[model samples]
Target: MSKAFTKEEDGTEKIRLDDLPQSTHPNLVTPSGLADLKARLAAARLELENLRARPEEIDSTMAIAVAERDIRFLESRISKAILIDPKDHSSGVVEFGATIDVVNEEDEQLTFRIVGEDEANPAQGLIAPYSPLGVALLGGETGGTVEWQKPSGVVELEIIAIRFE
Candidate 1:
């Protein structure tokens, strides 16, 4: 998975399944995935060929593709990047794997499914506990609000409740 994510502000609808504790996936390569990655590597190599032929004409698109390929290469090293144990419980206090219900500044209710960096999905409302908003909520008790700095200005969030899935 890619570390970069496009977060949507006006999005809604979420369900927190369970908190994953540890990763128990086998540390081995998937033969099919390896084969597919090899093909992509070959295709990228071909693109590089065309790029090399016109060194002065290569643009940012090709450059970005190369960079993305590099990232995928490194990511392929791990068999299971994000593993949810499906049994992690933070014991009431908001921890790394806790699911929280937050009300935004507009008084609209929202829920964010917090996960690890590998499993962070903004669309699914899964945020990394280490992120800015996540940091503010860590170790916080219910009924209190989490304050943080946003691009527009300072923002405050109230933790209505926490649901453990």
Candidate 2:
């Protein structure tokens, strides 16, 4: 219902880059990102195992291509994965991968995880920082509240917690 506004000594309102942390945690693996790579590896391994089980299929070029493609993708991803230092370490501010909990006036507690654009899945409560709600909640403090516009109307949220390490 409210927002964390800062005022200068001159009584002028101050703008913020974000309310949450922007730094990547020590572990930058988005669940989806990690899962995608893992699934590919597993699929490729399974295909290799299958080839051993069914010797007749071992010589099938098409079958080999199916498994090889998965392996290639995994190799490409893990090789280029950039593990960056956590962007915002201030415990006072929210950042990426922070599991924020907010209580609406209705007393319903909502949970969200700020993630990368490619990793966002609202159905799973993972939000991309570029999203309106995510942008509003970035660099926020645990006890701070925020407001942002939604398709329906103005929506409010409280920052219950944030994690950076």
Candidate 3:
């Protein structure tokens, strides 16, 4: 028999499942980030409950295991969350939860909001404060320049505005 068919000491074959990667950086969050985390935790709990109630479903064991793992992860994240109100920070410089308006060398204007890693969605203009562009923009005042490396080349951005709201 192949090793794949062998059972472990527990008398059960190990199931290989991929878990979500946790960020090592500080678990900082804006008020919105905190809210999102709570919502996620609640959703995960509901999902696990649903999975447990449907034991007859095909692959329900795997689903329940995955859901349980997700719940644990979400719970950990929620417990570690440090809430930071954006309004408390200075608006003159770019920082976490600051909405920034920048113009590139090409004069193309773009906007981004610096947020917590858990809340970051680049496609939605939300970036993690530890991200390259976010780090470069931090502490930068309006009219200051920041640069970030891209596959094509390093791009420079000029800060036009920073708002805490």
Best by lDDT: 3
User: What TM-score does candidate 3 reach?
Assistant: 0.87
Cα misplacement distance, residue 67 of candidate 3 (Å) = 0.5
- Give lDDT tens digits, candidate 1, residues 24-140: 433222233344445656676666566556645536444544544554553453335334432355466776566788887999888876565545677887776667777877776
Task: Tell me the spans in candidate 2 whose CA falls farther than 4 Å from its real position.
Answer: 1-43, 48-64, 84-90, 116-121, 130-132, 147-154
Ranking by TM-score: 3, 2, 1
Quote the RMSD, in angstroms, for model 3: 4.0
List residue ranges in candidate 3 displaced over 4 A.
1-19
Global local distance difference test of model 1: 0.59
Candidate 2, residues 57-93: lDDT per residue as tens digits? 5354345444555566566565555443344455667
lDDT string for model 3 (1-165, tens) is 111234559674434355567889989999999998889889988987897687678887677667767877888888888888889987698878899999999999999999999999999999999998888888999999989777789999999999998
What's the lDDT for residue 13 in model 3?
47
Q: How high is the CA lDDT of each candidate model? A: 0.59, 0.65, 0.84
Name the 10 consecutive residues with the lowest summed lDDT in model 3: 1-10
Where model 1 places Cα greater than 4 Å from the true spot, the runs are 1-86
TM-score of each: 0.50, 0.54, 0.87
To one decimal, what is the Cα RMSD in angstroms of model 2 from the true structure? 19.7
